[model samples]
Target: MPDYKAPLRDVRFLIDEVFDFAGGYQALGATDASPDMVSAILEEGAKFCEQVLAPLNRSGDEEGCHFDNGVVTTPKGFKEAYAQYVEGGWNGVSADPEYGGQGLPPSLGLLVSEMIGASNCSWGMYPGLTRGAMAAIHAHGTAEQKNAYLPRMTAGTWTGTMCLTEPHCGTDLGIIKTRAVPNADGSYAISGTKIFISAGEHDMSENIIHLVLAKLPDAPAGTKGISLFIVPKFTLDAAGEAGARNAVSCGSIEHKMGIKASATCVMNFDGATGYLIGEANKGLACMFTMMNHARLGTGMQGLCLGETSYQGAVKYARDRLQMRALTGPKAPDKPADPIIVHPDVRRMLLTMKAFNEGNRALAYFTAQLLDVEHLAESAEEREQAANLLAFLTPICKAFMTETGLEATNLGMQVFGGHGFIREWGMEQLVRDCRIAPIYEGTNGIQALDLLGRKVLGSQGKLLMGFTKLVHKLCQEHAEHPQLKAQVAQLAALNKQWGELTQKVGMAAMKNPDEVGAAAVDYLMFSGYITLGYFWLRMALVAQQKLEAGNGEADFYQAKLATADFYFARLLPRAAAHKAAVEAGGESLMRLSAEQFAL
Candidate 1:
């Protein structure tokens, strides 16, 4: 039993004060997006998550997804919950109004996504995958495809999935063996076996659209030869109704350790009726449009998992009576003192809170940049915003996920032995958070993309631009007392990252092996610096609110304390990662074949 509350106050503070969502909405021509409307949406979403989703999390994990023969059944309450979820218009929170969407900001959708993930990540995947698929179709599909698919997808009548990973290939798409043949009827016949497809085949929606990657016959080798095809489980009639059953079938469902509620199907598309999306030879490029969004969404999973675990740990620590404090028992008359009385316990709880809050700020900050990149009017302004957002995307995905796992682990630690038990639900958070680093191109790949393509390719333009934003913020700290130390630490860390990034870039040219050797460490190091910047902004906001003697005094005070803990404990890890990167690539690559055999 975990009682989860969405952090609405903090969300509002970020929306109103930090980034000005109202201004963004107006600039994007969304005049209806008033603060009151946004608040109402979040309140309703919070209720659904806390009441409906949170209660079923443990039960769903216990029940798991049921696969009998070829049909897949989601955990109990999932079907009914999904119906209710769609009825509430939750699926299309940020979709285009022309296609049944509410036309809200993607930032609002992201905020709701955080709550959904916090309550039940397993359940969230069903809709999460659908959104990702919709992004692909909406971006690259033809007008007919948009009319037929986008509406239902927005309404959640049809769920969706991305079929990319196969048994032989997960990251390298060029060598994939799946084939797509052009049919005389202006469609393609797709034949492929896809593995690790989340929400690949589920008995929840009316139809499941799979945007699969397969190579056309007469195509070049590797990534350039791959093409994207929209293959549905049931073929649609001329009127866009479910027509006859298609050849697409589920071979089996993966029996995973976590997210047992969302079915991971091994899909087999045998001569399936398929339509081309975007250009035939340019499939990888089209799919990447969806992947960029997917990567960020996956990162949020870590944040959500961390938030849920933190709430559960806090509830348990307050209720569970245990040994007395080291200095003196806070509850002298009681039979046993609450675990919160111990300094060590406080440290564990504070660590989780600090990381979770910092991550929240990071998600919101990156989301605001997304708004600027998409909606800004001027080309100069848009390019500047896009550059900053692009630079932070990998950091947001890699760092949030890495720290999210750390925060969840801290949550488990706070519960001590109770966390390891199945009944407590702490172990589930740990398991669910573990996959974020592995998915959306393992964190190692993310690092190389950041250092090799984004940083070095631009000759440090993106990195330096981000540095300028930090400098501007630091200059603002002259008037604020609380953020002085945090700002200094961030400045130092950014300088180290800047110098190390330049060195890594230059070394990578001389020997490409050097990039692979230090990619993960560099990614993690940058993640720390970015999150530190977020915490500093949060501390500044919290300090301002507390000074006003607002009603949320305790909440604001807690925010400041957590910010201090992040600077002292978490931000320093980046320095060591930088040192490790500078130690030369030989430490990672110099081992002989015989030595590696052991």
Candidate 2:
């Protein structure tokens, strides 16, 4: 197993250099998140992740979680690691200050989260789900609900879970059968079974707060009738301490291919006490507040796994001897040259590096938008940021995970037979990363959301909002001597992205299936272009640093090189996606469901 190291340098580069998070913080009134404060937080976050979480990753995977009756116990060392995580105050780094949180910007929390996730994804899920639940409650919960639940959750005394999926329903929530009935005290009895609930039942925290979705008695049919509720595993006493065990119980824990240590439970809420959140029949809207947060975090998982895989692959490539380089013997004294000397190995390494770095930039940029959306002073600014986020969220979730899976697979491929062996730990990454694209509304669902709802649903305004940012960047750098070429490339792609959306919109008008067929490809295409813009920005920054005779010439030069590789090798992928998107829905729909089988 390879050791996980936080990419602190690259993280700092993005936070300090590329994104200007300090300036963003100032604008957002996050006066406490100064550069010095942010640096200290990141450094401390890195130490905890590296020292505490990384060691348990493989062991956790091996041990998995043990389930007995209704109780779920996490793998050995997980409880201890989680204790240390809470001790370090990592859980509420970005929660509302009014709720016992550190009250840092969401982006900073995401930065720390990236490290935690890469170090130990299974352990990270415990708190990751909590953050999502907290977001939902904070956004939609009543004052009493927030005051009662937020503090314990922010204090890390209790963990939270979003219980949406059931044995029957996955994405199509309108057909869900979960039922909630009002009680004498105005609370509701939530009775349903939710499956695939991560952190649903665990001994790591004192209590589990579940954000549930169900239907009220007089509810209208379909999605409009759904309502959100907060159902705890153990109902709180008058003193706000967990007292009587609620009707909620873990039916069983799932045995999975990867991320086994993260308890995926089948939670049975049988007349459990639940409090309504937001409007009576607006549960889906409230749940989306959590889902969007989870979706972005899920997208980050791709980058986290990719980063860990890349680190392992790079280490192995540098040390593992293999056939000599094609040109000549690079390691003359050794039996054979290290695999890093080979062209194919270099290709794999570069591909992993390109995606990892490019995705980081994209994630951080979106994180900044999240800050603006939450804290900006002006309504217009917040609205603009919200519009951009709405457009980018699906792309970020789908593209990053798809590319992340690619990067992790390439990492394993670079290892040959050794990669398949579990002891080497490469295969575990592949298994762990596989679920990212499948969950969080699946990449297919995300594609439809992106193209159908966000892009075409708005008549291309949402997309244009993002393209405008790209155009502005291009215009700013068009006159620069060294960056002119990259600027022009981004400019052309920006124009083409809009045109492609229009073409797809026209085809979708003729046949609605056209949207579904072209959605994923369209998203991937947009992702390539989006990353292309970020890579160019990074390259331009590196170019400036080089011109200024910076001491970190190697780092800057590598950034420029990766940018070049991304454009030359990866950006062309967009062309293929575009071709498929232009192919329309005919070929895809022609195949009968039965024909998909052997």
Candidate 3:
């Protein structure tokens, strides 16, 4: 009834055929993640997503979450499902083995997470936050801190929350009012009120570990002064289990437009016992370790919702008997032909399909870079992957969400009247997805990070790291029989991407506002080109398979068709972005505050 199914076939296509994740895993010495193991995980992950998680998505949204006094209760079945998730060892698949994880590569974890998100994004938030928290502790926490938290957190008996935003600050961490004061016994007392803390308080786990950002007494003026703290809901006993209640409590939970089942809390930390992570005045850097992972995860939220939308729309389009096709009735046996007969409907369906599949390929490729960055032997290889990861991350977060939002809207459009209805479940997805662009360092901030910090800040070294790969792909496929034109289109766009960055970089030097003005459009241009590169590469693989008479001709043909649709329709949007970048910032900044009101 939920109409959600995991696209394991497509996952297999991306991992096996398109990205060669098997080879990638082996190359990275991830012998534990063999082809058989990967396949089994995919199959099992799909089953859990479809049977266990998908059914609860609608119920979770309708019931939302409950807050009583300071206690938060998730929607019915959420706790049970989480129990199954932890029991199945899904929590530790890609976490560190030292901390009870299976020590799998991070990319495989992402592949499973895609299924989890598609089936139940609201449910996914619980473990999702936990994983981000684990990464922060793993990277920056002390050995004692790791021993205290990582094992249980990875085991999923306890969960985690990233508490940074206050009622006052969302993006500006430097201006935070929360303060940390030293106590006699080497710990600190943290007092702060953090708002919009997802999974801030919940009943599903025994204890909650909060990674809070607060400034010390003698800290510097801005962001550099901020420090990271490990604040727990309940103090740990000698057994290291949750013992006495800490000073932290849920002040209230937000009544959100969506993801309501996941409690986004207003946490009140009244002089809670806290342990410092990394160093004093160095919390923001420590938090970025978690945020980068979150940004990628948040990007996949777009894909998850979009993929579900496509499945529902496709089913509806096939079964719903609408007006006869303009050409004629393809199904004359029925009173009217299905809307799938219509060109307009086909256009909508293809757009959703192309964006969903293309975005999947893009996410998968970027995910693999994580394994390379972490596990590769060569320092040069690791650095290259890291550079590419940094450059692509903002795009992954911003671009995927932007296009994915578009895809969800198109899914609703395909269903027409029914899309707005609750039972159809399309509208709920739109409501849920509405937040992805705004949160996780908003798409606008992501754009600025891409243009200002990652690209221009590196003096284009980081941008070149990615563009060189684009150039290589272009050169390799310059003469392909089927994809030559598409490759040429991609090649030209890749060249222009560099030129436009240089143009923006030059203008930004003259007027610092140029970066802000051109950032979103610049990022969009870059995203379009990035997805185009991936799509073109997918087309090449699909074409080669078709030529060689490989498995599932229909599947391969559909892939080629989607890639063609992407090139023909989606990639041209880059031109408009390029034009906007060239248009400069004058128009954007023209209206004085007083004049705007007049």
By descending TM-score, how would the candidates be arranged?
3, 2, 1
TM-score of each: 0.97, 0.99, 0.99
Best model number under lDDT: 2
Residues 1-598, model 3: lDDT tens digits: 3478889889888898889998998889999999999988989999999999999999999999999999899999999999999999999999999999999999989999999999999999999999999999999999999999999999999999999999988999999999899999889999989999999999999999999999999999999899999999999999988999999999999999988788999999999999999999999889999999999999999899999999989999999998898888899899999888899999999988988887898899888999998899999999998999999999999988998899899999998988989988998888889899999899999999999999999999999998999999999879988889998999999899889988998998899999999999999999889888888888888889989987689998998888899899889999999999999999999999999889
Count of clashing residue pairs in every prediction:
2, 0, 0
Runs of candidate 2 with Cα error greater than 4 angstroms are none
What is the overall TM-score of model 3 with all chains considered together?
Answer: 0.99
Candidate 2 backbone collisions, by pair? none
lDDT by residue for model 1 over 1-598, one digit each (tens)? 4678887877787788767889888887767778788989989999999889988999999999888888999888989989999999999988988999998777888999999999989999999989989988988899999998999999999999999999988898788888999999999999989999999888899999999999899999888898999998899998898889999988898878788888888999899999999998899888887788888898898889988888888899887899887777778888788998888888888878877777888888878776666666788877987888788888878888888898889888888898998888899999888989898888888888898889888899999998877778877784566677778878777778788988987888899998888888888888888878878887888888788877778987877888888889878888789888998789777788899888
lDDT of each: 0.86, 0.93, 0.92
Alpha-carbon RMSD of each model: 1.5, 1.0, 0.9
For model 3 the local lDDT of residue 85 reads: 91
Residue 439 of model 3 has an lDDT of 90
What is the lDDT, from 0 to 100, of the residue 181 in candidate 2?
A: 95
- Which residues of candidate 1, in runs, are more than 4 Å off? none
- Show the lowest summed lDDT stretch of 10 residues, model 3: 1-10
